[model samples]
Target: MTAEREAEFDFTHPFYQTGLAIGVPREDSAGILRSLGALLSWQFLSLVAGLGLLLLAVGSLLWLVERRRNAEQFGGSPAQGIGASFWWAAVTMTTVGYGDKAPVTLAGRLIALVWMFAGLIMVASFTAAITSALTVSNLQRQINGPRDLPGLRVATVADTASAQYLTEQRIEQARYPDLPTAMRAVADGAADAVVYDQPLLQYRNRELGERRLDILRNTFAEQLYAFALPAGSELRGPLAQEVLRVTESAEWQSLMDAYLGHR
Candidate 1:
Protein backbone atom coordinates (compact mmCIF):
# COMPACT_ATOMS: atom_id res chain seq x y z
CA MET A 1 0.00 0.00 0.00
CA THR A 2 2.83 2.53 0.99
CA ALA A 3 4.82 1.66 -2.22
CA GLU A 4 1.78 2.25 -4.43
CA ARG A 5 1.13 5.69 -2.82
CA GLU A 6 4.80 6.72 -3.20
CA ALA A 7 4.75 5.79 -6.94
CA GLU A 8 1.57 7.86 -7.46
CA PHE A 9 3.07 10.90 -5.66
CA ASP A 10 6.27 10.76 -7.75
CA PHE A 11 4.31 10.66 -11.02
CA THR A 12 2.03 13.49 -9.93
CA HIS A 13 4.86 16.02 -9.34
CA PRO A 14 5.55 17.99 -12.61
CA PHE A 15 8.52 19.71 -10.92
CA TYR A 16 10.33 16.37 -10.50
CA GLN A 17 9.72 15.57 -14.15
CA THR A 18 11.10 18.97 -15.15
CA GLY A 19 14.18 18.47 -12.96
CA LEU A 20 14.82 15.09 -14.64
CA ALA A 21 14.44 16.72 -18.09
CA ILE A 22 17.09 19.27 -17.23
CA GLY A 23 19.37 16.48 -15.87
CA VAL A 24 19.65 18.24 -12.49
CA PRO A 25 19.23 16.12 -9.42
CA ARG A 26 16.94 17.52 -6.73
CA GLU A 27 19.79 17.29 -4.20
CA ASP A 28 22.05 19.38 -6.43
CA SER A 29 19.31 22.00 -6.81
CA ALA A 30 18.93 22.17 -3.07
CA GLY A 31 22.70 22.61 -2.65
CA ILE A 32 22.69 25.49 -5.13
CA LEU A 33 19.88 27.16 -3.21
CA ARG A 34 21.83 26.83 0.01
CA SER A 35 24.94 28.35 -1.59
CA LEU A 36 22.89 31.30 -2.85
CA GLY A 37 21.47 31.82 0.59
CA ALA A 38 24.92 31.81 2.16
CA LEU A 39 26.11 34.40 -0.33
CA LEU A 40 23.31 36.70 0.87
CA SER A 41 24.16 36.18 4.51
CA TRP A 42 26.16 38.32 6.97
CA GLN A 43 28.86 35.64 7.10
CA PHE A 44 30.02 36.56 3.58
CA LEU A 45 30.22 40.24 4.48
CA SER A 46 32.13 39.40 7.64
CA LEU A 47 34.68 37.42 5.63
CA VAL A 48 35.28 40.44 3.40
CA ALA A 49 35.64 42.69 6.44
CA GLY A 50 38.13 40.27 7.98
CA LEU A 51 40.32 40.28 4.85
CA GLY A 52 40.32 44.11 4.85
CA LEU A 53 41.37 44.15 8.48
CA LEU A 54 44.22 41.73 7.79
CA LEU A 55 45.57 43.97 5.04
CA LEU A 56 45.42 46.96 7.38
CA ALA A 57 47.25 45.01 10.06
CA VAL A 58 50.05 44.00 7.71
CA GLY A 59 50.47 47.59 6.54
CA SER A 60 50.59 48.81 10.13
CA LEU A 61 53.19 46.24 11.10
CA LEU A 62 55.44 47.40 8.29
CA TRP A 63 54.95 51.02 9.29
CA LEU A 64 55.76 50.42 12.95
CA VAL A 65 58.92 48.49 12.17
CA GLU A 66 60.06 51.41 10.04
CA ARG A 67 59.21 53.91 12.77
CA ARG A 68 61.15 52.09 15.41
CA ARG A 69 64.27 52.08 13.25
CA ASN A 70 63.98 55.79 12.50
CA ALA A 71 63.43 56.76 16.14
CA GLU A 72 66.54 54.89 17.16
CA GLN A 73 68.59 56.58 14.43
CA PHE A 74 67.57 60.22 14.84
CA GLY A 75 65.88 60.53 18.20
CA GLY A 76 68.15 63.41 19.17
CA SER A 77 67.49 65.70 16.20
CA PRO A 78 64.75 68.32 16.61
CA ALA A 79 63.42 67.60 13.12
CA GLN A 80 63.41 63.84 13.66
CA GLY A 81 60.31 62.44 15.31
CA ILE A 82 57.79 59.68 14.73
CA GLY A 83 56.30 61.62 11.82
CA ALA A 84 59.70 62.28 10.31
CA SER A 85 60.48 58.57 10.61
CA PHE A 86 57.51 57.80 8.39
CA TRP A 87 58.84 60.00 5.59
CA TRP A 88 62.32 58.60 5.97
CA ALA A 89 60.98 55.05 5.84
CA ALA A 90 59.18 55.75 2.58
CA VAL A 91 62.27 57.32 1.04
CA THR A 92 64.54 54.57 2.18
CA MET A 93 62.25 51.82 0.90
CA THR A 94 61.94 53.59 -2.44
CA THR A 95 65.75 53.74 -2.60
CA VAL A 96 65.54 57.48 -3.26
CA GLY A 97 68.13 58.27 -0.54
CA TYR A 98 67.93 62.01 -1.25
CA GLY A 99 70.62 62.63 1.44
CA ASP A 100 68.68 65.55 2.88
CA LYS A 101 69.16 63.90 6.29
CA ALA A 102 71.82 61.85 7.95
CA PRO A 103 72.17 59.64 11.04
CA VAL A 104 75.03 60.19 13.46
CA THR A 105 76.52 58.36 16.45
CA LEU A 106 76.82 54.71 17.56
CA ALA A 107 73.15 54.20 18.32
CA GLY A 108 72.21 55.48 14.90
CA ARG A 109 74.58 53.07 13.15
CA LEU A 110 73.15 50.21 15.16
CA ILE A 111 69.68 51.24 14.05
CA ALA A 112 70.96 51.20 10.47
CA LEU A 113 71.53 47.47 10.83
CA VAL A 114 67.83 46.81 11.33
CA TRP A 115 66.82 49.32 8.64
CA MET A 116 69.10 47.84 6.02
CA PHE A 117 67.60 44.36 6.24
CA ALA A 118 64.01 45.30 7.03
CA GLY A 119 63.95 48.01 4.38
CA LEU A 120 64.58 45.55 1.55
CA ILE A 121 61.92 43.10 2.73
CA MET A 122 59.44 45.88 3.42
CA VAL A 123 59.97 47.49 0.03
CA ALA A 124 59.46 44.26 -1.91
CA SER A 125 56.37 43.22 0.07
CA PHE A 126 54.85 46.69 -0.02
CA THR A 127 55.44 47.03 -3.75
CA ALA A 128 53.67 43.74 -4.46
CA ALA A 129 50.73 44.67 -2.23
CA ILE A 130 50.26 48.16 -3.65
CA THR A 131 50.62 47.10 -7.26
CA SER A 132 48.22 44.17 -6.90
CA ALA A 133 45.71 46.35 -5.07
CA LEU A 134 45.98 49.18 -7.57
CA THR A 135 45.58 46.91 -10.57
CA VAL A 136 42.47 45.26 -9.14
CA SER A 137 41.08 48.60 -7.97
CA ASN A 138 41.61 50.16 -11.37
CA LEU A 139 39.88 47.31 -13.18
CA GLN A 140 36.96 46.92 -10.75
CA ARG A 141 36.59 50.61 -9.77
CA GLN A 142 37.81 52.02 -13.09
CA ILE A 143 40.49 53.99 -11.30
CA ASN A 144 44.12 53.36 -10.28
CA GLY A 145 58.15 44.66 -7.03
CA PRO A 146 60.93 42.97 -7.19
CA ARG A 147 64.52 41.95 -6.59
CA ASP A 148 67.44 42.46 -8.97
CA LEU A 149 66.94 40.16 -11.96
CA PRO A 150 69.07 37.10 -11.37
CA GLY A 151 71.86 37.22 -13.94
CA LEU A 152 75.35 38.56 -14.27
CA ARG A 153 73.77 41.82 -15.49
CA VAL A 154 70.87 43.09 -17.64
CA ALA A 155 70.09 46.22 -19.65
CA THR A 156 67.04 48.24 -20.69
CA VAL A 157 66.86 50.83 -23.46
CA ALA A 158 67.08 54.34 -22.15
CA ASP A 159 63.99 56.57 -21.93
CA THR A 160 61.67 53.91 -23.30
CA ALA A 161 58.61 52.44 -21.63
CA SER A 162 60.57 49.25 -21.03
CA ALA A 163 63.25 51.18 -19.22
CA GLN A 164 60.73 53.09 -17.18
CA TYR A 165 58.84 49.97 -16.18
CA LEU A 166 62.00 48.04 -15.31
CA THR A 167 63.31 50.93 -13.24
CA GLU A 168 60.03 51.32 -11.40
CA GLN A 169 59.97 47.59 -10.64
CA ARG A 170 63.47 47.94 -9.11
CA ILE A 171 65.17 45.42 -11.40
CA GLU A 172 68.94 45.81 -11.51
CA GLN A 173 69.66 46.95 -15.07
CA ALA A 174 71.80 49.18 -17.22
CA ARG A 175 70.63 51.32 -20.17
CA TYR A 176 71.76 50.74 -23.75
CA PRO A 177 71.30 52.87 -26.88
CA ASP A 178 70.03 50.30 -29.39
CA LEU A 179 68.48 46.85 -29.41
CA PRO A 180 71.62 45.23 -30.78
CA THR A 181 73.74 46.75 -28.02
CA ALA A 182 71.32 45.47 -25.45
CA MET A 183 71.31 42.08 -27.14
CA ARG A 184 75.09 42.08 -27.25
CA ALA A 185 75.21 42.73 -23.55
CA VAL A 186 73.12 39.64 -22.94
CA ALA A 187 74.97 37.50 -25.52
CA ASP A 188 78.36 38.36 -24.10
CA GLY A 189 77.27 37.33 -20.58
CA ALA A 190 77.28 40.94 -19.36
CA ALA A 191 73.47 40.79 -19.10
CA ASP A 192 70.65 38.27 -18.95
CA ALA A 193 67.63 39.46 -20.94
CA VAL A 194 67.01 42.80 -22.65
CA VAL A 195 63.77 44.12 -21.16
CA TYR A 196 61.58 45.56 -23.92
CA ASP A 197 58.19 45.39 -25.66
CA GLN A 198 56.57 42.29 -27.13
CA PRO A 199 57.81 43.00 -30.66
CA LEU A 200 61.39 43.60 -29.57
CA LEU A 201 61.32 40.62 -27.25
CA GLN A 202 60.02 38.42 -30.06
CA TYR A 203 62.72 39.65 -32.40
CA ARG A 204 65.37 38.88 -29.82
CA ASN A 205 63.92 35.42 -29.31
CA ARG A 206 64.33 34.66 -33.03
CA GLU A 207 67.70 36.35 -33.62
CA LEU A 208 69.42 35.05 -30.52
CA GLY A 209 69.66 31.46 -29.31
CA GLU A 210 65.95 31.15 -28.63
CA ARG A 211 66.34 28.56 -25.93
CA ARG A 212 69.15 30.43 -24.19
CA LEU A 213 67.21 33.46 -22.98
CA ASP A 214 63.74 33.65 -21.45
CA ILE A 215 61.17 36.46 -21.34
CA LEU A 216 59.99 37.35 -17.89
CA ARG A 217 56.23 36.72 -18.04
CA ASN A 218 55.89 39.29 -15.33
CA THR A 219 54.68 42.37 -17.19
CA PHE A 220 54.83 45.55 -15.15
CA ALA A 221 51.97 47.60 -16.62
CA GLU A 222 49.43 46.07 -18.99
CA GLN A 223 48.45 49.46 -20.38
CA LEU A 224 50.39 51.10 -23.18
CA TYR A 225 52.87 53.34 -21.43
CA ALA A 226 51.97 57.04 -21.35
CA PHE A 227 53.27 60.20 -19.84
CA ALA A 228 51.79 62.38 -17.10
CA LEU A 229 52.28 66.11 -16.75
CA PRO A 230 51.96 68.66 -13.98
CA ALA A 231 48.58 69.90 -15.23
CA GLY A 232 46.58 70.90 -18.34
CA SER A 233 48.20 68.16 -20.37
CA GLU A 234 45.79 66.63 -22.82
CA LEU A 235 46.01 62.98 -23.95
CA ARG A 236 47.18 61.70 -20.57
CA GLY A 237 44.50 59.74 -18.75
CA PRO A 238 42.31 59.21 -21.81
CA LEU A 239 45.21 57.81 -23.79
CA ALA A 240 46.09 55.45 -20.97
CA GLN A 241 42.52 54.20 -20.65
CA GLU A 242 42.19 53.75 -24.40
CA VAL A 243 45.37 51.71 -24.56
CA LEU A 244 44.32 49.54 -21.64
CA ARG A 245 40.87 48.91 -23.10
CA VAL A 246 42.25 47.91 -26.50
CA THR A 247 44.89 45.64 -25.01
CA GLU A 248 42.21 43.77 -23.10
CA SER A 249 39.88 43.35 -26.08
CA ALA A 250 39.30 40.41 -28.43
CA GLU A 251 40.86 42.39 -31.29
CA TRP A 252 44.10 42.51 -29.34
CA GLN A 253 43.97 38.74 -28.99
CA SER A 254 43.75 38.38 -32.80
CA LEU A 255 46.61 40.83 -33.21
CA MET A 256 48.73 38.79 -30.87
CA ASP A 257 47.88 35.63 -32.78
CA ALA A 258 49.02 37.22 -36.04
CA TYR A 259 52.12 38.87 -34.60
CA LEU A 260 53.29 36.16 -32.23
CA GLY A 261 52.03 33.29 -34.44
CA HIS A 262 52.25 31.10 -31.33
CA ARG A 263 50.74 31.09 -27.85
Candidate 2:
Protein backbone atom coordinates (compact mmCIF):
# COMPACT_ATOMS: atom_id res chain seq x y z
CA MET A 1 0.00 0.00 0.00
CA THR A 2 1.12 3.54 -0.74
CA ALA A 3 2.10 5.72 2.25
CA GLU A 4 -1.11 7.71 1.71
CA ARG A 5 -3.24 4.51 1.69
CA GLU A 6 -1.38 3.30 4.80
CA ALA A 7 -2.02 6.58 6.56
CA GLU A 8 -5.66 6.45 5.53
CA PHE A 9 -6.09 2.94 6.98
CA ASP A 10 -4.03 3.70 10.13
CA PHE A 11 -6.87 3.56 12.62
CA THR A 12 -4.39 2.83 15.43
CA HIS A 13 -2.66 6.19 14.95
CA PRO A 14 -2.39 8.14 18.16
CA PHE A 15 -4.61 11.01 17.05
CA TYR A 16 -6.43 10.59 13.78
CA GLN A 17 -8.81 7.64 13.86
CA THR A 18 -12.49 8.49 14.35
CA GLY A 19 -14.02 5.03 14.09
CA LEU A 20 -13.54 1.65 15.79
CA ALA A 21 -10.82 -0.54 14.27
CA ILE A 22 -12.81 -3.71 14.90
CA GLY A 23 -15.54 -2.48 12.55
CA VAL A 24 -18.08 -1.79 15.26
CA PRO A 25 -20.58 0.30 13.36
CA ARG A 26 -21.88 3.62 14.62
CA GLU A 27 -25.20 1.87 15.31
CA ASP A 28 -23.44 -0.51 17.67
CA SER A 29 -21.78 2.37 19.47
CA ALA A 30 -25.13 4.07 19.81
CA GLY A 31 -26.68 0.88 21.12
CA ILE A 32 -23.96 0.42 23.72
CA LEU A 33 -24.34 3.99 24.86
CA ARG A 34 -28.09 3.55 25.03
CA SER A 35 -27.75 0.46 27.18
CA LEU A 36 -25.41 2.22 29.56
CA GLY A 37 -27.76 5.15 29.66
CA ALA A 38 -30.56 2.79 30.60
CA LEU A 39 -28.57 1.33 33.47
CA LEU A 40 -27.72 4.77 34.79
CA SER A 41 -31.33 5.80 34.45
CA TRP A 42 -32.38 2.79 36.49
CA GLN A 43 -30.07 3.76 39.28
CA PHE A 44 -31.08 7.39 39.33
CA LEU A 45 -34.76 6.52 39.37
CA SER A 46 -34.23 4.11 42.20
CA LEU A 47 -32.74 6.90 44.28
CA VAL A 48 -35.54 9.30 43.43
CA ALA A 49 -38.14 6.65 44.14
CA GLY A 50 -36.61 5.90 47.51
CA LEU A 51 -36.43 9.57 48.39
CA GLY A 52 -39.95 10.16 47.19
CA LEU A 53 -41.26 7.37 49.37
CA LEU A 54 -39.35 8.73 52.32
CA LEU A 55 -40.72 12.19 51.74
CA LEU A 56 -44.25 10.84 51.62
CA ALA A 57 -43.78 8.95 54.85
CA VAL A 58 -42.16 11.86 56.66
CA GLY A 59 -44.53 14.45 55.28
CA SER A 60 -47.51 12.40 56.36
CA LEU A 61 -46.17 12.07 59.87
CA LEU A 62 -45.28 15.74 60.17
CA TRP A 63 -48.59 16.93 58.80
CA LEU A 64 -50.48 14.71 61.21
CA VAL A 65 -48.59 16.04 64.21
CA GLU A 66 -48.80 19.69 63.14
CA ARG A 67 -52.27 19.76 61.60
CA ARG A 68 -54.18 21.07 64.65
CA ARG A 69 -51.77 23.93 65.23
CA ASN A 70 -51.79 24.82 61.55
CA ALA A 71 -55.61 24.72 61.41
CA GLU A 72 -56.00 27.11 64.34
CA GLN A 73 -53.39 29.40 62.85
CA PHE A 74 -55.07 29.31 59.47
CA GLY A 75 -58.39 30.45 61.08
CA GLY A 76 -59.97 27.00 60.98
CA SER A 77 -59.19 26.51 57.29
CA PRO A 78 -59.41 22.96 55.99
CA ALA A 79 -56.07 23.69 54.32
CA GLN A 80 -54.70 22.49 57.66
CA GLY A 81 -56.34 19.10 57.11
CA ILE A 82 -54.22 15.98 56.78
CA GLY A 83 -54.24 15.89 52.98
CA ALA A 84 -53.44 19.55 52.61
CA SER A 85 -50.81 19.44 55.30
CA PHE A 86 -49.23 16.44 53.60
CA TRP A 87 -49.29 18.26 50.29
CA TRP A 88 -47.63 21.30 51.82
CA ALA A 89 -45.01 19.14 53.44
CA ALA A 90 -44.29 17.31 50.19
CA VAL A 91 -43.88 20.54 48.25
CA THR A 92 -41.65 21.97 50.96
CA MET A 93 -39.54 18.82 51.26
CA THR A 94 -38.78 18.56 47.56
CA THR A 95 -38.57 22.32 47.08
CA VAL A 96 -40.89 21.95 44.16
CA GLY A 97 -41.96 25.46 43.14
CA TYR A 98 -45.66 25.16 42.62
CA GLY A 99 -47.19 28.61 43.25
CA ASP A 100 -50.63 27.26 43.97
CA LYS A 101 -52.04 27.10 47.56
CA ALA A 102 -49.34 28.83 49.55
CA PRO A 103 -50.31 30.46 52.84
CA VAL A 104 -52.16 33.76 52.15
CA THR A 105 -52.57 35.09 55.71
CA LEU A 106 -49.60 36.61 57.57
CA ALA A 107 -49.45 34.00 60.35
CA GLY A 108 -50.14 31.21 57.89
CA ARG A 109 -47.46 32.48 55.52
CA LEU A 110 -44.92 32.74 58.36
CA ILE A 111 -45.72 29.21 59.44
CA ALA A 112 -45.52 28.09 55.83
CA LEU A 113 -42.13 29.69 55.40
CA VAL A 114 -40.86 27.96 58.50
CA TRP A 115 -42.24 24.69 57.27
CA MET A 116 -40.64 25.30 53.90
CA PHE A 117 -37.20 25.71 55.39
CA ALA A 118 -37.78 22.78 57.67
CA GLY A 119 -38.76 20.72 54.69
CA LEU A 120 -35.56 21.73 52.92
CA ILE A 121 -33.41 20.55 55.79
CA MET A 122 -35.40 17.36 56.22
CA VAL A 123 -35.18 16.53 52.53
CA ALA A 124 -31.44 17.04 52.51
CA SER A 125 -30.99 14.95 55.62
CA PHE A 126 -33.22 12.25 54.23
CA THR A 127 -31.28 12.15 50.96
CA ALA A 128 -27.94 11.84 52.71
CA ALA A 129 -29.26 9.10 54.96
CA ILE A 130 -30.64 7.17 52.00
CA THR A 131 -27.42 7.47 50.02
CA SER A 132 -25.34 6.31 52.95
CA ALA A 133 -27.67 3.40 53.58
CA LEU A 134 -27.66 2.33 49.95
CA THR A 135 -23.90 2.66 49.69
CA VAL A 136 -23.49 0.46 52.72
CA SER A 137 -25.99 -2.07 51.38
CA ASN A 138 -24.34 -2.07 47.97
CA LEU A 139 -20.85 -2.44 49.40
CA GLN A 140 -21.90 -5.49 51.39
CA ARG A 141 -22.28 -7.37 48.12
CA GLN A 142 -18.62 -7.14 47.02
CA ILE A 143 -15.60 -8.82 48.49
CA ASN A 144 -12.62 -6.46 49.14
CA GLY A 145 -10.64 -5.52 45.96
CA PRO A 146 -8.27 -6.72 43.18
CA ARG A 147 -8.88 -10.24 41.93
CA ASP A 148 -6.03 -10.75 39.44
CA LEU A 149 -3.53 -12.13 41.95
CA PRO A 150 -3.04 -15.87 42.13
CA GLY A 151 -4.89 -17.81 44.85
CA LEU A 152 -7.14 -14.79 45.21
CA ARG A 153 -10.74 -15.76 44.89
CA VAL A 154 -12.27 -12.30 44.86
CA ALA A 155 -15.99 -11.82 45.18
CA THR A 156 -18.33 -8.95 44.31
CA VAL A 157 -21.71 -8.02 45.67
CA ALA A 158 -24.39 -9.92 43.81
CA ASP A 159 -26.26 -8.10 40.97
CA THR A 160 -23.84 -5.20 41.21
CA ALA A 161 -21.96 -3.66 38.35
CA SER A 162 -18.69 -5.05 39.72
CA ALA A 163 -20.08 -8.55 39.45
CA GLN A 164 -21.20 -7.75 35.93
CA TYR A 165 -17.68 -6.63 35.08
CA LEU A 166 -16.23 -9.86 36.44
CA THR A 167 -18.60 -11.91 34.36
CA GLU A 168 -17.60 -9.91 31.30
CA GLN A 169 -13.90 -10.51 31.97
CA ARG A 170 -14.50 -14.28 32.39
CA ILE A 171 -13.10 -13.95 35.90
CA GLU A 172 -14.41 -16.53 38.30
CA GLN A 173 -16.51 -14.76 40.93
CA ALA A 174 -18.23 -15.56 44.19
CA ARG A 175 -21.38 -13.69 45.06
CA TYR A 176 -22.45 -12.71 48.53
CA PRO A 177 -25.70 -11.38 49.95
CA ASP A 178 -23.98 -8.97 52.34
CA LEU A 179 -20.65 -7.46 53.36
CA PRO A 180 -20.27 -9.08 56.75
CA THR A 181 -20.59 -12.52 55.21
CA ALA A 182 -18.12 -11.54 52.51
CA MET A 183 -15.66 -10.23 55.10
CA ARG A 184 -16.05 -13.42 57.09
CA ALA A 185 -15.25 -15.37 53.95
CA VAL A 186 -12.06 -13.35 53.55
CA ALA A 187 -11.14 -13.76 57.23
CA ASP A 188 -11.68 -17.49 56.85
CA GLY A 189 -9.32 -17.56 53.85
CA ALA A 190 -12.13 -18.44 51.49
CA ALA A 191 -11.31 -15.44 49.26
CA ASP A 192 -8.12 -13.59 48.65
CA ALA A 193 -9.42 -10.20 47.63
CA VAL A 194 -12.70 -8.30 47.43
CA VAL A 195 -13.87 -6.31 44.42
CA TYR A 196 -16.35 -3.62 45.32
CA ASP A 197 -17.09 0.11 45.03
CA GLN A 198 -14.67 2.74 46.27
CA PRO A 199 -16.94 3.80 49.15
CA LEU A 200 -17.22 0.24 50.41
CA LEU A 201 -13.51 -0.27 50.02
CA GLN A 202 -12.75 2.91 51.94
CA TYR A 203 -15.14 2.06 54.75
CA ARG A 204 -13.76 -1.48 55.10
CA ASN A 205 -10.18 -0.34 54.87
CA ARG A 206 -10.83 1.85 57.88
CA GLU A 207 -12.72 -0.88 59.74
CA LEU A 208 -10.11 -3.56 59.05
CA GLY A 209 -7.30 -1.77 60.79
CA GLU A 210 -4.20 -3.98 61.31
CA ARG A 211 -5.41 -6.45 58.70
CA ARG A 212 -2.80 -7.79 56.22
CA LEU A 213 -5.05 -7.32 53.21
CA ASP A 214 -3.69 -5.45 50.22
CA ILE A 215 -5.93 -3.19 48.18
CA LEU A 216 -4.78 -3.37 44.57
CA ARG A 217 -3.58 -0.38 42.58
CA ASN A 218 -5.31 -1.67 39.51
CA THR A 219 -8.93 -0.49 39.25
CA PHE A 220 -11.06 -2.59 36.92
CA ALA A 221 -13.88 -0.25 36.06
CA GLU A 222 -15.23 3.21 36.79
CA GLN A 223 -18.79 2.22 37.49
CA LEU A 224 -21.18 5.09 38.19
CA TYR A 225 -23.05 4.60 41.48
CA ALA A 226 -26.74 5.09 40.94
CA PHE A 227 -30.16 4.12 42.15
CA ALA A 228 -31.55 1.01 40.48
CA LEU A 229 -35.13 0.35 39.45
CA PRO A 230 -37.03 -1.79 36.99
CA ALA A 231 -36.29 -1.08 33.33
CA GLY A 232 -38.27 1.47 31.29
CA SER A 233 -39.58 3.52 34.17
CA GLU A 234 -40.77 7.03 33.23
CA LEU A 235 -38.67 8.87 35.80
CA ARG A 236 -35.47 7.00 34.95
CA GLY A 237 -33.97 9.00 32.11
CA PRO A 238 -34.75 12.47 33.45
CA LEU A 239 -33.42 11.62 36.91
CA ALA A 240 -30.24 10.16 35.41
CA GLN A 241 -29.70 13.24 33.29
CA GLU A 242 -30.32 15.50 36.30
CA VAL A 243 -27.87 13.52 38.40
CA LEU A 244 -25.24 13.70 35.66
CA ARG A 245 -25.76 17.41 35.42
CA VAL A 246 -25.49 17.81 39.19
CA THR A 247 -22.44 15.57 39.33
CA GLU A 248 -20.76 17.62 36.63
CA SER A 249 -21.58 20.88 38.38
CA ALA A 250 -18.91 22.65 40.43
CA GLU A 251 -20.89 22.23 43.66
CA TRP A 252 -21.12 18.49 43.10
CA GLN A 253 -17.44 18.26 42.27
CA SER A 254 -16.53 20.13 45.44
CA LEU A 255 -18.78 17.89 47.53
CA MET A 256 -17.19 14.80 45.98
CA ASP A 257 -13.69 16.11 46.57
CA ALA A 258 -14.56 16.93 50.14
CA TYR A 259 -15.78 13.38 50.71
CA LEU A 260 -13.56 11.30 48.38
CA GLY A 261 -10.52 13.58 48.17
CA HIS A 262 -9.01 15.42 45.18
CA ARG A 263 -8.36 12.31 43.10
Q: Pick the candidate with the highest TM-score.
A: 2
Residues 118-202, candidate 1: write the lDDT tens digits. Answer: 6687667655654554443223211101233433255668887667666676666788997667766665545544666655565
- Each prediction's total of clashing residue pairs, residues at least 3 apart in sequence or on different chains, is 1, 8
lDDT of 2 at 168: 77
Work out the TM-score per prediction: 0.31, 0.32
User: How far is 232's C-alpha from truth in model 1 (Å)?
Assistant: 14
- Worst lDDT window (10 residues) for model 1? 15-24
The residue ranges of model 1 lying beyond 4 angstroms of the native Cα positions read 1-145, 148-152, 166-171, 209-212, 225-254
Tens digit per residue, CA lDDT, model 2, 1-263: 12433443321212111110010012322344434444355555687687667656654554545545555422234444545655665776678857544554565556567767877777787677556655543343233344333233666679766676667767777889975566556545466456666555544544554442344434556533454434445666666677667766779756654554432
Candidate 1 residue 36 C-alpha distance from true site, Å: 60
Prediction 1 global C-alpha lDDT: 0.48
Residue pairs in clash, model 2: 43-227, 43-228, 140-179, 141-157, 142-157, 143-194, 144-194, 145-194
Query: How well does model 2 score by local distance difference test?
Result: 0.52
